[model samples]
Target: MTFVTSEPYIGHMGLGGIGDSKGLLESELRKRHIKWVDNARVTSVDQDKVNVEQLDEKGRVANTHELPFAYSMLIPPFAGVDAVQGIEGLVNPGGFILIDKHQRNPKWPNILAAGVCVAIPPSRPPRCLPAHRRPD
Candidate 1:
Protein backbone atom coordinates (compact mmCIF):
# COMPACT_ATOMS: atom_id res chain seq x y z
CA MET A 1 0.00 0.00 0.00
CA THR A 2 1.04 3.57 -0.54
CA PHE A 3 0.29 6.59 1.62
CA VAL A 4 0.29 10.06 0.14
CA THR A 5 -0.03 13.26 2.10
CA SER A 6 0.70 16.98 2.01
CA GLU A 7 2.38 16.79 5.42
CA PRO A 8 6.00 17.88 5.34
CA TYR A 9 6.90 14.62 7.05
CA ILE A 10 5.39 11.46 8.36
CA GLY A 11 3.06 11.57 11.38
CA HIS A 12 2.55 15.32 11.15
CA MET A 13 -1.16 14.63 11.42
CA GLY A 14 -1.77 18.33 10.70
CA LEU A 15 -0.97 19.33 14.32
CA GLY A 16 2.82 19.20 13.88
CA GLY A 17 2.45 15.68 15.25
CA ILE A 18 2.64 14.29 18.75
CA GLY A 19 5.89 13.30 20.46
CA ASP A 20 7.90 10.72 18.50
CA SER A 21 5.03 10.22 16.11
CA LYS A 22 7.32 10.64 13.13
CA GLY A 23 9.71 7.97 14.27
CA LEU A 24 7.00 5.60 15.44
CA LEU A 25 4.88 5.87 12.31
CA GLU A 26 7.87 5.60 10.03
CA SER A 27 9.01 2.51 11.84
CA GLU A 28 5.60 0.95 11.58
CA LEU A 29 5.29 1.67 7.85
CA ARG A 30 8.73 0.23 7.33
CA LYS A 31 7.81 -2.87 9.25
CA ARG A 32 4.71 -3.29 7.15
CA HIS A 33 6.57 -2.54 3.91
CA ILE A 34 4.22 0.26 3.06
CA LYS A 35 5.48 3.16 0.99
CA TRP A 36 4.71 6.82 1.54
CA VAL A 37 5.04 10.02 -0.43
CA ASP A 38 5.25 13.22 1.55
CA ASN A 39 4.49 16.72 0.37
CA ALA A 40 2.31 15.01 -2.18
CA ARG A 41 -0.36 16.62 -4.29
CA VAL A 42 -2.86 14.49 -6.12
CA THR A 43 -3.30 15.90 -9.53
CA SER A 44 -5.63 13.28 -10.80
CA VAL A 45 -7.00 9.82 -10.13
CA ASP A 46 -8.01 7.18 -12.62
CA GLN A 47 -9.33 3.68 -12.35
CA ASP A 48 -6.00 2.04 -11.61
CA LYS A 49 -3.65 4.88 -10.95
CA VAL A 50 -3.36 7.99 -8.87
CA ASN A 51 -1.29 10.77 -10.36
CA VAL A 52 0.71 12.47 -7.66
CA GLU A 53 3.11 15.33 -7.72
CA GLN A 54 5.93 15.09 -5.21
CA LEU A 55 6.75 18.62 -4.16
CA ASP A 56 10.10 19.88 -3.00
CA GLU A 57 10.74 22.17 -0.05
CA LYS A 58 10.21 25.15 -2.33
CA GLY A 59 6.68 24.08 -3.14
CA ARG A 60 7.68 23.06 -6.64
CA VAL A 61 7.17 19.68 -8.16
CA ALA A 62 10.29 17.62 -7.63
CA ASN A 63 8.86 14.55 -9.34
CA THR A 64 5.64 13.12 -10.63
CA HIS A 65 4.60 9.64 -9.61
CA GLU A 66 1.99 7.37 -11.10
CA LEU A 67 1.01 5.09 -8.29
CA PRO A 68 -0.97 2.05 -9.18
CA PHE A 69 -3.50 0.77 -6.69
CA ALA A 70 -6.09 -1.92 -6.66
CA TYR A 71 -8.05 0.07 -4.15
CA SER A 72 -7.77 3.63 -2.94
CA MET A 73 -9.25 5.88 -0.33
CA LEU A 74 -9.05 9.62 -0.22
CA ILE A 75 -9.96 11.79 2.70
CA PRO A 76 -11.12 15.08 1.29
CA PRO A 77 -9.76 18.24 2.81
CA PHE A 78 -11.69 19.92 5.65
CA ALA A 79 -13.61 23.18 5.56
CA GLY A 80 -15.96 25.14 7.76
CA VAL A 81 -19.63 25.72 6.99
CA ASP A 82 -20.78 28.29 4.45
CA ALA A 83 -22.17 30.55 7.15
CA VAL A 84 -18.68 31.19 8.52
CA GLN A 85 -16.97 31.61 5.18
CA GLY A 86 -16.03 35.03 3.77
CA ILE A 87 -16.31 36.61 7.20
CA GLU A 88 -13.06 38.51 7.49
CA GLY A 89 -11.15 38.01 10.74
CA LEU A 90 -13.63 35.35 11.75
CA VAL A 91 -12.30 32.44 9.76
CA ASN A 92 -9.31 31.29 7.81
CA PRO A 93 -9.14 31.06 4.03
CA GLY A 94 -10.47 27.54 4.19
CA GLY A 95 -13.39 28.85 6.19
CA PHE A 96 -12.57 27.12 9.46
CA ILE A 97 -13.49 29.37 12.34
CA LEU A 98 -10.53 31.10 13.92
CA ILE A 99 -10.78 30.87 17.68
CA ASP A 100 -8.87 31.99 20.71
CA LYS A 101 -7.59 29.86 23.57
CA HIS A 102 -11.05 29.87 25.05
CA GLN A 103 -12.63 28.80 21.74
CA ARG A 104 -14.05 32.24 21.20
CA ASN A 105 -13.66 34.09 17.93
CA PRO A 106 -11.19 36.87 18.48
CA LYS A 107 -13.01 39.39 16.31
CA TRP A 108 -16.40 38.28 17.53
CA PRO A 109 -15.83 37.52 21.18
CA ASN A 110 -19.42 36.60 21.83
CA ILE A 111 -19.31 33.82 19.25
CA LEU A 112 -17.94 30.45 20.30
CA ALA A 113 -16.74 27.81 17.85
CA ALA A 114 -16.42 24.18 18.74
CA GLY A 115 -15.80 20.78 17.26
CA VAL A 116 -14.41 20.40 13.74
CA CYS A 117 -15.41 23.90 12.78
CA VAL A 118 -12.58 25.29 14.90
CA ALA A 119 -9.30 26.02 13.19
CA ILE A 120 -6.17 24.78 14.88
CA PRO A 121 -2.99 26.15 13.40
CA PRO A 122 -0.02 23.86 13.21
CA SER A 123 2.36 24.13 16.12
CA ARG A 124 5.15 24.75 13.62
CA PRO A 125 5.17 26.02 10.06
CA PRO A 126 5.59 23.43 7.34
CA ARG A 127 9.02 23.62 5.75
CA CYS A 128 7.67 25.07 2.52
CA LEU A 129 4.48 23.21 1.86
CA PRO A 130 1.32 25.18 1.47
CA ALA A 131 -1.48 24.81 3.95
CA HIS A 132 -4.06 22.24 2.88
CA ARG A 133 -6.73 23.93 0.84
CA ARG A 134 -10.13 22.56 0.11
CA PRO A 135 -10.60 21.29 -3.45
CA ASP A 136 -12.48 23.61 -5.76
Candidate 2:
Protein backbone atom coordinates (compact mmCIF):
# COMPACT_ATOMS: atom_id res chain seq x y z
CA MET A 1 0.00 0.00 0.00
CA THR A 2 1.00 3.62 -0.45
CA PHE A 3 0.44 6.77 1.59
CA VAL A 4 1.13 10.14 0.04
CA THR A 5 1.81 13.40 1.84
CA SER A 6 2.63 16.93 0.78
CA GLU A 7 4.93 17.29 3.76
CA PRO A 8 8.50 16.14 3.63
CA TYR A 9 7.69 14.20 6.78
CA ILE A 10 4.43 12.88 8.20
CA GLY A 11 2.56 13.67 11.46
CA HIS A 12 2.16 17.45 11.10
CA MET A 13 -1.44 16.98 12.26
CA GLY A 14 0.08 15.11 15.19
CA LEU A 15 -1.98 11.97 14.68
CA GLY A 16 -1.60 9.65 17.70
CA GLY A 17 0.66 12.31 19.10
CA ILE A 18 3.32 11.30 16.60
CA GLY A 19 4.13 14.68 15.07
CA ASP A 20 7.14 15.22 17.32
CA SER A 21 8.84 12.09 15.99
CA LYS A 22 7.71 12.06 12.40
CA GLY A 23 10.96 10.63 11.15
CA LEU A 24 10.62 7.62 13.42
CA LEU A 25 7.07 6.98 12.29
CA GLU A 26 8.23 7.24 8.72
CA SER A 27 10.90 4.64 9.41
CA GLU A 28 8.27 2.31 10.87
CA LEU A 29 6.08 2.83 7.83
CA ARG A 30 8.98 1.86 5.62
CA LYS A 31 9.70 -1.26 7.68
CA ARG A 32 6.14 -2.35 7.02
CA HIS A 33 6.78 -2.09 3.30
CA ILE A 34 4.37 0.77 2.77
CA LYS A 35 5.35 3.17 0.06
CA TRP A 36 5.42 6.70 1.39
CA VAL A 37 5.25 9.39 -1.25
CA ASP A 38 6.32 12.72 0.17
CA ASN A 39 6.02 16.18 -1.30
CA ALA A 40 3.12 15.03 -3.45
CA ARG A 41 -0.37 16.54 -3.47
CA VAL A 42 -3.83 15.80 -4.73
CA THR A 43 -4.89 18.07 -7.54
CA SER A 44 -8.38 16.73 -8.21
CA VAL A 45 -10.78 13.91 -7.42
CA ASP A 46 -13.72 12.11 -8.98
CA GLN A 47 -15.68 8.99 -8.26
CA ASP A 48 -13.35 6.03 -8.76
CA LYS A 49 -10.25 8.21 -9.16
CA VAL A 50 -8.00 10.94 -7.77
CA ASN A 51 -5.68 13.19 -9.70
CA VAL A 52 -2.33 13.72 -7.97
CA GLU A 53 0.60 15.99 -8.61
CA GLN A 54 4.08 14.90 -7.65
CA LEU A 55 6.31 17.79 -6.72
CA ASP A 56 9.94 18.25 -7.68
CA GLU A 57 12.71 18.80 -5.14
CA LYS A 58 11.83 22.49 -5.13
CA GLY A 59 8.13 21.75 -4.49
CA ARG A 60 6.91 22.58 -7.97
CA VAL A 61 4.61 20.18 -9.74
CA ALA A 62 6.74 17.81 -11.78
CA ASN A 63 4.15 15.24 -12.82
CA THR A 64 0.51 14.35 -12.49
CA HIS A 65 -1.42 11.08 -12.56
CA GLU A 66 -4.51 9.21 -11.49
CA LEU A 67 -5.11 7.06 -8.41
CA PRO A 68 -8.24 5.00 -8.84
CA PHE A 69 -10.46 3.86 -6.03
CA ALA A 70 -13.84 2.22 -5.57
CA TYR A 71 -15.35 4.76 -3.13
CA SER A 72 -15.43 8.52 -2.44
CA MET A 73 -16.86 11.24 -0.20
CA LEU A 74 -16.18 14.94 0.52
CA ILE A 75 -16.47 17.64 3.19
CA PRO A 76 -15.88 21.31 2.46
CA PRO A 77 -13.40 23.52 4.32
CA PHE A 78 -14.64 25.70 7.19
CA ALA A 79 -15.03 29.43 6.82
CA GLY A 80 -15.41 32.41 9.13
CA VAL A 81 -18.84 33.75 10.09
CA ASP A 82 -20.41 35.77 7.28
CA ALA A 83 -19.99 38.84 9.45
CA VAL A 84 -16.22 38.65 9.01
CA GLN A 85 -15.67 37.81 5.35
CA GLY A 86 -13.47 40.18 3.26
CA ILE A 87 -12.71 42.22 6.38
CA GLU A 88 -9.16 43.48 6.80
CA GLY A 89 -6.71 40.89 8.13
CA LEU A 90 -9.17 39.34 10.55
CA VAL A 91 -9.02 35.91 8.98
CA ASN A 92 -6.71 33.57 7.14
CA PRO A 93 -6.76 32.74 3.46
CA GLY A 94 -9.29 29.98 4.16
CA GLY A 95 -11.64 32.58 5.63
CA PHE A 96 -11.35 31.25 9.16
CA ILE A 97 -10.51 33.41 12.11
CA LEU A 98 -6.90 33.59 13.22
CA ILE A 99 -6.37 33.09 16.93
CA ASP A 100 -3.66 32.88 19.54
CA LYS A 101 -3.35 30.33 22.33
CA HIS A 102 -6.18 32.14 24.07
CA GLN A 103 -8.30 31.93 20.94
CA ARG A 104 -8.45 35.70 20.70
CA ASN A 105 -7.82 37.54 17.47
CA PRO A 106 -4.57 39.40 18.06
CA LYS A 107 -5.71 42.44 16.14
CA TRP A 108 -9.30 42.40 17.42
CA PRO A 109 -8.55 41.56 21.01
CA ASN A 110 -12.24 41.49 21.86
CA ILE A 111 -12.86 38.74 19.29
CA LEU A 112 -12.62 35.10 20.33
CA ALA A 113 -13.05 31.87 18.39
CA ALA A 114 -12.88 28.11 18.61
CA GLY A 115 -14.04 24.87 16.97
CA VAL A 116 -15.41 25.32 13.42
CA CYS A 117 -14.93 29.06 13.51
CA VAL A 118 -11.16 28.50 13.44
CA ALA A 119 -9.55 26.44 10.75
CA ILE A 120 -7.68 23.36 11.96
CA PRO A 121 -6.90 21.57 8.77
CA PRO A 122 -7.34 17.82 8.77
CA SER A 123 -4.35 15.51 9.20
CA ARG A 124 -4.44 13.14 6.28
CA PRO A 125 -5.93 11.78 3.14
CA PRO A 126 -7.05 15.40 2.90
CA ARG A 127 -10.38 17.11 3.55
CA CYS A 128 -10.96 15.88 7.11
CA LEU A 129 -9.83 12.33 6.41
CA PRO A 130 -13.23 11.30 5.07
CA ALA A 131 -13.45 7.54 4.71
CA HIS A 132 -13.96 8.39 1.08
CA ARG A 133 -13.44 12.00 0.01
CA ARG A 134 -13.94 13.81 -3.25
CA PRO A 135 -12.63 17.17 -4.36
CA ASP A 136 -14.77 20.28 -3.93
Candidate 3:
Protein backbone atom coordinates (compact mmCIF):
# COMPACT_ATOMS: atom_id res chain seq x y z
CA MET A 1 0.00 0.00 0.00
CA THR A 2 1.05 3.60 -0.62
CA PHE A 3 0.61 6.45 1.90
CA VAL A 4 0.53 10.22 1.41
CA THR A 5 0.49 13.13 3.84
CA SER A 6 -2.27 15.58 2.98
CA GLU A 7 -1.07 19.16 2.96
CA PRO A 8 -3.63 21.87 3.80
CA TYR A 9 -2.63 23.90 0.71
CA ILE A 10 -4.12 21.16 -1.46
CA GLY A 11 -7.55 22.61 -0.63
CA HIS A 12 -6.62 26.01 -2.08
CA MET A 13 -5.72 24.34 -5.38
CA GLY A 14 -9.39 23.16 -5.63
CA LEU A 15 -10.83 20.03 -4.10
CA GLY A 16 -12.03 18.71 -7.45
CA GLY A 17 -8.57 19.04 -8.96
CA ILE A 18 -6.97 17.30 -6.03
CA GLY A 19 -9.59 14.55 -6.01
CA ASP A 20 -9.32 14.01 -9.75
CA SER A 21 -5.53 13.78 -9.58
CA LYS A 22 -5.78 11.35 -6.70
CA GLY A 23 -8.43 9.38 -8.57
CA LEU A 24 -6.21 9.08 -11.65
CA LEU A 25 -3.25 8.01 -9.55
CA GLU A 26 -5.41 5.53 -7.70
CA SER A 27 -6.83 4.19 -10.90
CA GLU A 28 -3.38 3.48 -12.26
CA LEU A 29 -2.41 1.75 -9.04
CA ARG A 30 -5.69 -0.16 -9.02
CA LYS A 31 -4.90 -1.51 -12.47
CA ARG A 32 -1.89 -3.17 -10.86
CA HIS A 33 -4.04 -4.18 -7.86
CA ILE A 34 -1.95 -2.12 -5.44
CA LYS A 35 -3.70 -1.02 -2.24
CA TRP A 36 -3.28 2.49 -0.80
CA VAL A 37 -3.89 4.46 2.36
CA ASP A 38 -4.16 8.24 2.94
CA ASN A 39 -4.34 10.57 5.96
CA ALA A 40 -2.47 8.01 8.06
CA ARG A 41 0.75 8.77 9.97
CA VAL A 42 3.55 6.34 10.52
CA THR A 43 4.35 6.10 14.21
CA SER A 44 7.21 3.67 13.98
CA VAL A 45 8.83 1.22 11.63
CA ASP A 46 10.69 -2.04 11.94
CA GLN A 47 12.52 -4.30 9.54
CA ASP A 48 9.39 -6.10 8.43
CA LYS A 49 6.46 -3.73 9.07
CA VAL A 50 5.42 -0.17 9.92
CA ASN A 51 3.09 0.92 12.71
CA VAL A 52 0.59 3.55 11.58
CA GLU A 53 -1.73 5.75 13.60
CA GLN A 54 -4.95 7.02 12.06
CA LEU A 55 -6.02 10.56 12.87
CA ASP A 56 -9.55 11.85 13.34
CA GLU A 57 -11.21 15.13 12.34
CA LYS A 58 -9.64 16.86 15.35
CA GLY A 59 -6.18 15.43 14.50
CA ARG A 60 -6.23 12.99 17.35
CA VAL A 61 -4.94 9.46 17.04
CA ALA A 62 -8.06 7.38 16.62
CA ASN A 63 -6.64 3.95 15.80
CA THR A 64 -3.37 2.12 15.17
CA HIS A 65 -2.49 -0.61 12.72
CA GLU A 66 0.54 -2.46 11.40
CA LEU A 67 1.21 -2.85 7.70
CA PRO A 68 3.82 -4.92 5.96
CA PHE A 69 5.31 -3.76 2.69
CA ALA A 70 8.11 -4.89 0.41
CA TYR A 71 9.26 -1.29 -0.06
CA SER A 72 8.61 2.03 1.66
CA MET A 73 9.57 5.69 1.59
CA LEU A 74 9.07 8.09 4.48
CA ILE A 75 9.16 11.89 4.55
CA PRO A 76 9.38 13.30 8.05
CA PRO A 77 8.41 16.73 9.33
CA PHE A 78 10.95 19.54 9.28
CA ALA A 79 12.21 21.33 12.39
CA GLY A 80 14.98 23.65 13.51
CA VAL A 81 18.11 22.83 15.42
CA ASP A 82 18.21 21.97 19.12
CA ALA A 83 18.58 24.67 21.74
CA VAL A 84 22.12 25.34 22.97
CA GLN A 85 23.00 27.06 26.22
CA GLY A 86 26.07 27.73 28.36
CA ILE A 87 28.10 28.39 25.21
CA GLU A 88 29.48 31.87 24.45
CA GLY A 89 29.40 33.30 20.88
CA LEU A 90 28.12 29.98 19.59
CA VAL A 91 24.47 30.66 18.89
CA ASN A 92 22.64 33.09 16.58
CA PRO A 93 19.90 35.43 17.78
CA GLY A 94 17.27 33.50 15.82
CA GLY A 95 17.84 30.41 18.00
CA PHE A 96 19.79 28.58 15.30
CA ILE A 97 23.28 28.04 16.67
CA LEU A 98 25.78 30.07 14.64
CA ILE A 99 28.44 28.68 12.32
CA ASP A 100 31.06 30.01 9.95
CA LYS A 101 31.06 29.81 6.14
CA HIS A 102 32.61 26.34 6.32
CA GLN A 103 29.72 25.25 8.56
CA ARG A 104 31.93 25.21 11.65
CA ASN A 105 30.98 27.02 14.82
CA PRO A 106 33.17 30.03 15.55
CA LYS A 107 33.52 29.35 19.27
CA TRP A 108 33.64 25.58 18.90
CA PRO A 109 35.65 24.78 15.83
CA ASN A 110 35.02 21.06 16.13
CA ILE A 111 31.26 21.57 15.85
CA LEU A 112 29.62 21.60 12.40
CA ALA A 113 26.15 22.67 11.43
CA ALA A 114 23.46 21.46 9.00
CA GLY A 115 19.73 21.90 8.48
CA VAL A 116 18.26 25.25 9.55
CA CYS A 117 21.14 25.90 11.91
CA VAL A 118 23.42 26.92 9.02
CA ALA A 119 23.01 30.65 8.51
CA ILE A 120 23.03 32.38 5.11
CA PRO A 121 23.98 36.04 4.97
CA PRO A 122 21.78 38.51 3.14
CA SER A 123 22.89 39.47 -0.36
CA ARG A 124 22.18 43.19 0.11
CA PRO A 125 22.90 44.81 3.45
CA PRO A 126 23.85 48.06 5.18
CA ARG A 127 27.34 48.14 6.72
CA CYS A 128 26.02 48.49 10.28
CA LEU A 129 23.08 46.14 10.27
CA PRO A 130 21.33 45.24 13.52
CA ALA A 131 22.30 42.06 15.33
CA HIS A 132 18.94 40.51 14.49
CA ARG A 133 19.36 41.26 10.78
CA ARG A 134 22.89 39.92 10.40
CA PRO A 135 23.33 36.25 9.56
CA ASP A 136 26.17 35.86 12.15
Candidate 4:
Protein backbone atom coordinates (compact mmCIF):
# COMPACT_ATOMS: atom_id res chain seq x y z
CA MET A 1 0.00 0.00 0.00
CA THR A 2 1.26 3.45 -0.92
CA PHE A 3 0.00 6.76 0.44
CA VAL A 4 0.79 9.79 -1.69
CA THR A 5 0.46 13.30 -0.44
CA SER A 6 1.82 16.65 -1.60
CA GLU A 7 3.06 17.62 1.84
CA PRO A 8 6.11 16.02 3.40
CA TYR A 9 5.13 15.74 7.06
CA ILE A 10 2.97 13.07 8.62
CA GLY A 11 0.60 13.05 11.58
CA HIS A 12 -0.61 16.58 10.90
CA MET A 13 -2.80 16.79 13.97
CA GLY A 14 -2.63 19.58 16.55
CA LEU A 15 -1.11 17.76 19.54
CA GLY A 16 2.28 17.33 17.91
CA GLY A 17 3.85 19.91 15.62
CA ILE A 18 4.74 18.69 12.12
CA GLY A 19 8.36 18.15 13.09
CA ASP A 20 7.71 16.03 16.18
CA SER A 21 5.18 13.50 14.86
CA LYS A 22 6.88 12.72 11.56
CA GLY A 23 9.75 10.86 13.21
CA LEU A 24 7.41 8.37 14.84
CA LEU A 25 5.31 8.04 11.72
CA GLU A 26 8.37 7.59 9.53
CA SER A 27 9.82 5.01 11.91
CA GLU A 28 6.59 3.05 11.88
CA LEU A 29 6.36 3.29 8.12
CA ARG A 30 9.91 1.99 7.93
CA LYS A 31 9.04 -0.82 10.36
CA ARG A 32 6.05 -1.76 8.21
CA HIS A 33 7.89 -0.79 5.02
CA ILE A 34 5.66 1.88 3.53
CA LYS A 35 6.94 4.19 0.85
CA TRP A 36 6.36 7.83 1.60
CA VAL A 37 6.92 10.38 -1.14
CA ASP A 38 6.92 14.05 -0.24
CA ASN A 39 6.59 17.11 -2.45
CA ALA A 40 5.11 15.12 -5.32
CA ARG A 41 2.25 16.00 -7.62
CA VAL A 42 0.15 13.30 -9.23
CA THR A 43 -0.51 14.25 -12.79
CA SER A 44 -2.65 11.33 -13.82
CA VAL A 45 -4.03 8.00 -12.66
CA ASP A 46 -5.07 4.93 -14.59
CA GLN A 47 -5.91 1.28 -14.00
CA ASP A 48 -2.35 0.05 -13.56
CA LYS A 49 -0.31 3.13 -12.77
CA VAL A 50 -0.27 6.66 -11.44
CA ASN A 51 1.81 9.29 -13.17
CA VAL A 52 3.77 11.61 -10.94
CA GLU A 53 5.34 14.92 -11.81
CA GLN A 54 8.26 16.07 -9.70
CA LEU A 55 9.59 19.56 -9.92
CA ASP A 56 13.15 20.78 -10.11
CA GLU A 57 14.71 23.43 -7.87
CA LYS A 58 13.80 26.08 -10.42
CA GLY A 59 10.09 25.20 -10.18
CA ARG A 60 10.03 23.37 -13.48
CA VAL A 61 9.07 19.78 -14.13
CA ALA A 62 12.29 17.89 -13.62
CA ASN A 63 10.99 14.37 -13.90
CA THR A 64 7.88 12.41 -14.67
CA HIS A 65 7.48 8.81 -13.57
CA GLU A 66 4.90 6.11 -13.29
CA LEU A 67 4.06 4.29 -10.07
CA PRO A 68 2.44 0.91 -10.30
CA PHE A 69 -0.18 -0.22 -7.85
CA ALA A 70 -2.31 -3.27 -7.34
CA TYR A 71 -4.55 -1.46 -4.91
CA SER A 72 -4.10 2.24 -4.20
CA MET A 73 -6.04 4.75 -2.20
CA LEU A 74 -5.81 8.38 -3.17
CA ILE A 75 -6.63 11.11 -0.69
CA PRO A 76 -6.66 14.36 -2.59
CA PRO A 77 -6.41 17.82 -1.12
CA PHE A 78 -9.09 18.67 1.42
CA ALA A 79 -11.53 21.33 0.46
CA GLY A 80 -14.48 22.66 2.39
CA VAL A 81 -17.47 20.43 1.75
CA ASP A 82 -19.97 21.44 -0.89
CA ALA A 83 -22.49 22.25 1.80
CA VAL A 84 -20.72 25.36 3.05
CA GLN A 85 -18.31 26.04 0.20
CA GLY A 86 -18.73 29.25 -1.80
CA ILE A 87 -21.28 30.72 0.58
CA GLU A 88 -20.41 34.39 0.72
CA GLY A 89 -19.36 34.69 4.34
CA LEU A 90 -19.06 31.09 5.48
CA VAL A 91 -15.76 30.26 3.80
CA ASN A 92 -12.60 32.03 2.86
CA PRO A 93 -11.49 32.58 -0.72
CA GLY A 94 -9.77 29.21 -0.63
CA GLY A 95 -12.95 27.56 0.62
CA PHE A 96 -11.75 26.87 4.13
CA ILE A 97 -14.31 27.32 6.82
CA LEU A 98 -13.96 30.64 8.61
CA ILE A 99 -14.05 30.27 12.35
CA ASP A 100 -13.72 32.46 15.36
CA LYS A 101 -11.65 31.89 18.51
CA HIS A 102 -13.93 29.02 19.46
CA GLN A 103 -13.63 27.26 16.06
CA ARG A 104 -17.26 28.08 15.56
CA ASN A 105 -18.36 29.95 12.47
CA PRO A 106 -18.05 33.64 13.19
CA LYS A 107 -21.10 34.74 11.31
CA TRP A 108 -23.21 31.80 12.35
CA PRO A 109 -21.92 31.06 15.82
CA ASN A 110 -23.89 27.84 16.14
CA ILE A 111 -22.00 26.17 13.33
CA LEU A 112 -18.80 24.47 14.42
CA ALA A 113 -16.12 22.83 12.30
CA ALA A 114 -13.03 20.73 12.79
CA GLY A 115 -10.51 18.84 10.73
CA VAL A 116 -8.48 19.78 7.63
CA CYS A 117 -10.89 22.34 6.27
CA VAL A 118 -10.69 24.92 9.02
CA ALA A 119 -8.90 28.14 8.03
CA ILE A 120 -5.59 28.49 9.83
CA PRO A 121 -2.52 30.28 8.56
CA PRO A 122 0.66 28.42 7.83
CA SER A 123 3.16 28.50 10.68
CA ARG A 124 6.43 27.90 8.87
CA PRO A 125 6.52 29.15 5.32
CA PRO A 126 4.70 30.75 2.43
CA ARG A 127 2.33 27.79 2.03
CA CYS A 128 1.66 25.03 4.51
CA LEU A 129 -1.37 23.97 6.48
CA PRO A 130 -1.22 21.95 9.64
CA ALA A 131 -3.95 21.30 12.13
CA HIS A 132 -4.39 24.19 14.56
CA ARG A 133 -5.95 23.84 17.97
CA ARG A 134 -7.35 26.41 20.37
CA PRO A 135 -4.48 25.77 22.85
CA ASP A 136 -6.24 23.84 25.56
Q: Which numbered prediction scores highest in TM-score against the true structure?
A: 1
TM-score: model 1 vs. ground truth:
0.86
Q: Give the per-residue lDDT digits (tens) of candidate 2, residues 1-136.
A: 5676765556544222344567777788889997766667788888778788887755678887687777644444334678778666678765788888788888898988898777554444343334545344
lDDT of 3 by residue, 44-132 (tens): 89998988876664567767778887888886553235566434577655456677888888888899888765555434343234657
Measured by C-alpha RMSD in angstroms, how accurate is candidate 3?
Answer: 12.2
| TM-score of each model, in listed order | 0.86, 0.55, 0.43, 0.66
lDDT of 1 at 96: 91
Positional deviation of residue 56's Cα in model 4 after best superposition, in angstroms: 5.5
Best by lDDT: 1
> Positional deviation of 84 in candidate 3, in angstroms?
20
Per-candidate local distance difference test: 0.89, 0.66, 0.60, 0.70
Off by over 4 Å in 1: 129-136
lDDT of 4 at 105: 89
50-127 per-residue lDDT for model 1 (tens digits): 999998888889999999989999998767888879899999998999999999999999999899888898777665
lDDT value, residue 97 of candidate 4: 89
Winner by lDDT between candidate 4 and candidate 3: 4
Error of 2 at 118 (Å): 3.8
The predicted structure with the larger lDDT, 1 or 2, is 1
- Model 2 regions more than 4 Å off: 14-19, 44-49, 63-85, 115-136
